[model samples]
Target: MSKEDPKTNSGYERTLTNAHIQLIALGGTIGTGLFLGVGNSIHQAGPSVILIYIIVGIFLYFLMRALGELVLSDLHKHTYIEFIEKYLGKNIGFITGYLYWISWISLGMAEMTALGIYFQYWFPHLPTWVPGLITIVILLFINLLSARLFGNLEFSFAIIKIVTIIAFVFLIAYLLVTGGKTSFGPVGFGNLAKNGGFFATGANGFLGGFQMVIFSFVGVELIGLTAAEAQNPKVTIRKAINELPLRIILFYVMAILAILLVIPWNKIATTSSPFVQALGATGIRNAGSIINFVVISAAVSSTNSFLYSAGRLIFSVTYDGKGKWNETFGHLHRQLPQNGLILSACLMGLAPLVIILIGNQAFNFISSTSTSMFLIIWCLMILTHLSYRKQTPANKLTDFQMPQYPWLDYLTLAFFGLMIILLLSLPANRMAMISAILIFIILWAVSKIWHQERAI
Candidate 1:
């Protein structure tokens, strides 16, 4: 609440409770990626998209385990970037931190962009930019309030998504069991195989699914970031990280299965949510609108989360440093990273303009760009964890160890590497992949040149 800038960024209000942390963890994974992007995932992977989720979930679960262990090792640090700075050196940390922040900004842009698409469900005449621009304004106000308020808002949003998805899965299951009819005819599990079988999309299609599947899990690390704001970092993060696989299986795997069972993979809609499409096809009046509302909520919830993260990350990366960039973004206002929050919110506000420039492909392009950046950041994070395990003396190490040690760490890296290879191999994603790497190198050079100027 102090007016002046603090000398350090060591303290943050640990106001997020166990419930807040848990729901935020749940909320992070079930966003526009699952709701809107899944339609694209299904279109590309077919029914085999189910396996894609499981495979990605397992490795990311291991990623979370390693991240949990790292955060618990040092609760004083505000984010994993600091740990990366400690272990991987300042140059890598600086680049990773900024890239991570920009990635979150990109994610917010994607979510905000989707807001317009969702709103068009009800108000077809509404300009796409209006809803997204308005959403950024509103969510930014909510975020600037307090961490506790943000937690509470996210708790409510997460609950809405959780109930809607759970009920949806159950309804679909019941329909399949009792032979209930839809407008598309009786829903059945055979939809999983009827369209050309599980791997109907073939190996190339299956490989293509990995991109959006990775995008879906992009926010899985939110639990780790929230640890610094949790009242009980150890217990909260462990519970969230441990339960991740189950959450992925239920929210992602089952939800997609329910949608596909009702509408075959080849028949899935790509632009809007397949969830809404499935419900609309049920002959239930207002079903698509209801689910569309929920899908809109999911997008807003994620945009809020990303804005929060982007603000904090920008602050974390710039804290205690010199120069105008640090001076502008590093300080806290009334115990919040006001400058960082405003900056991120403003950038996200431009999402509508980007949508205008790119046309309908804006969301996919923005999400892909974000995913490319995260691939780099996640790689650095896993390396940071491995570096932690290597340097810490056995006697000083905490009991909350990442299971399987170095092997899991190496395997996780390989999975991410494969994702990178896949992205670079694709002509569509090649530009984003190359751009991410170039940004990292540029950031490194800029930091070196800046430091040398200071030394002279």
Candidate 2:
């Protein structure tokens, strides 16, 4: 295996290119959140959900830019956790690493549960756990193959999702231009306001929708994770982050816009994908089946990214000697983090089976939990970046700089803080927010005790 950045020596190899990095980032952000969760957003926010996406996207762009600058400052750093340890203290580093891992694990579990739901579309009589178990085993084998294989699989998955979105956009455009009618209604921009105005559900509904909308963008920052494996850390990461805005607009905003244009917001089903609901509304033959396959592909893509992220996160922390299992957990097999990979898979895979047994409520529970966790992780990254900037010498030059440095960073932090508070306003999200606070307290206590023991 070939190494990408040679500044630091680690067991892992860097075999990923810019294409893989871009697609992996895309695959992470675009999967189950948009495909499965969007229906629920539309159900709650009405057409006003579009604004929610834009708001979240703008703030996330700032977060990624800040992350890009931090990564470029030190190519030797493979994971953001290393940077956190340096800038914020060992205690924070430990807490952030564990929280980040937990967030991805929650996210992977959500995707796996979604996989089972999509599978049931074809085999309505089959148990959800059966498919969930099979997918977990298959993904474990694929991830264990090599780092490049995981990239390739995610690349394929991202392409399928992008193609599906593009196809939907063009199809909806054609229908609107031709003034076509579907089983649901006529296709046009009018469908947005026709239901009960754009803010059909009112301000409360729009505010409530943020819980789900925020989750859709959970994995967007995973681009930072690829810095270690990227062929050219600075160049590949810069290019990938630069292209994110276009992707957000195309894959998320435009796709959702197309769906609403074809199907009125009130008429969209909460239990099914809005894309599928819109596609099936066209009265096209076998459209439901086609979209079902696309959604299944989306779910699989999410799970792949989730597993990859969780493994790398665990390996990075342990490899750096931050955790007690440094030797055992950090040891590699053929340049891969086999121990971490298997451990992450085994633990995360159980979530789907449990969710299946618990029934529908588990879906919301996992989604909300991951959403709250990821929000805090993003905030931590921003804070780390701020500290890094403050400590830099006046004459120092960075290859990649976060534009509009101090003000934008502050603004982004403020927004994330507000979102956390707003999360409490919603009944569905309140528990997840409380759980996140409790988990952080627990991790902080654990890290402090462990440090005292190690010092003794």
Candidate 3:
């Protein structure tokens, strides 16, 4: 593919392939939380947490398909923000674009913090912030050097995660065949309906799982962002979008099932890594060490993905006059937005230091705040897709139109709305909800001020 101008942030080398794109999506979606945190969801909803993943995965599949359609319609339009601007009004586009950029930055910070925590497990004597700073520096260097290098790093990170998961699955199957101390014999599927009687937490439990389960799918749409950088946009986009749903089901559903089955729902502890607990139950001697390595890799890969996306989002917003930042922030080196990448990396490293100075409670507060911001961005994406579909000509929508168009779109919107309602009702999430709204208001006011000055 011919390169476009780097000055306008219109072009970059297309270096990613279909496999790279696929693993990128996998890395983004499957994080440490799913491997370690789903126990909380299980505690809340019992075996029915599986059902929640299925439902959310379906809607997200359609949402991504809708986004893919827009991406495929125009190869040059790499970011979803650009699509929003072309189809929706400029104001909505600007807000969505900036909100997304800020949300990802916050997420990158949180992931970096999580990385520090993971590192603490290995080296308790070292200060936590030390590792966080080191991680940021390493990722910045990789991201700044070249887009292809970043892709390769991410690709390898993703492969580590994928291989770990596949190994876990095989181990689970072997445990089932070997016949453990439990009465279910060699191969048991009874875990699905036995303990807590499957849906033990009842309807409310399923509703509660929706909160975090949705969060797990946070960065799946990032595949669209790779369009401009993929070797062949048309082929890569179609292949990635087509396989997303199956990947979600296999990677999420099956893995969670293996976890819950290996250890009873009630017995699993949310505070500890579920992978470690599950492997331990299977009588594996070095399970803890193995799981630690996997979780650490998970945290690093997630942070890397977030940093990449945040940089690109910022570059896009600044190029479009949606944000006030240095023009050099949009500059590319080796087909990557080096300035943006470095800036985001610095902020992420700074987050842990800010938290340590403030307190653990303050750190937790920022993490919650970031989650709420992510929810708002997700809701905006669905809404933007809805508006884009309405404005798009029906005849020209054939490239990769969302299956079950308006109905799926409406249902997805309703699902996100209910999630917001859930957030409002829960005391733990109330601060996050309010903080996100305030951020949106502040961004809107700033946009207004910028527009007024430009008109003069």
Overall lDDT per candidate, in order of appearance: 0.89, 0.85, 0.74
Candidate rank order under lDDT? 1, 2, 3
Best by lDDT: 1
In lDDT terms, how accurate is model 2? 0.85
Please tell me which model should have the higher lDDT, number 2 or number 3.
2
Model 1: per-residue lDDT, tens digit, 1-456? 222322224567778889999999999999999999998888889999999999999999988888888888877788899999999998888888888988999999999888888988889898888887888899999989998999999999999999999999999998889998776667997787686899998999999888888899898898888876788777888888889989998999999989988997888878788999999988878999999999999999999999999999999999989989899988788668989999999988889889889989999899889889999889999999999989999988878899989999999999999899999998878888898888888889987987788889
Supply candidate 1's per-residue lDDT for 423.
97
lDDT of 1 at 335: 69
Tens digits of lDDT, candidate 3, 1-456: 333333223757777776888788777778755764476678778888889889888878887887887788777775898878776666767787778887777766666665665665568676656666787788887787777777888889888888888888877877677755332233356777676688887777777676667666777888889888887767777888888888888789988888866777777776556777777666667777788788878878877888899888877777734334747775566667777887777777777666687553433445556667767766777777787778777887756788887788788878777777887776766877788888888888887887787788
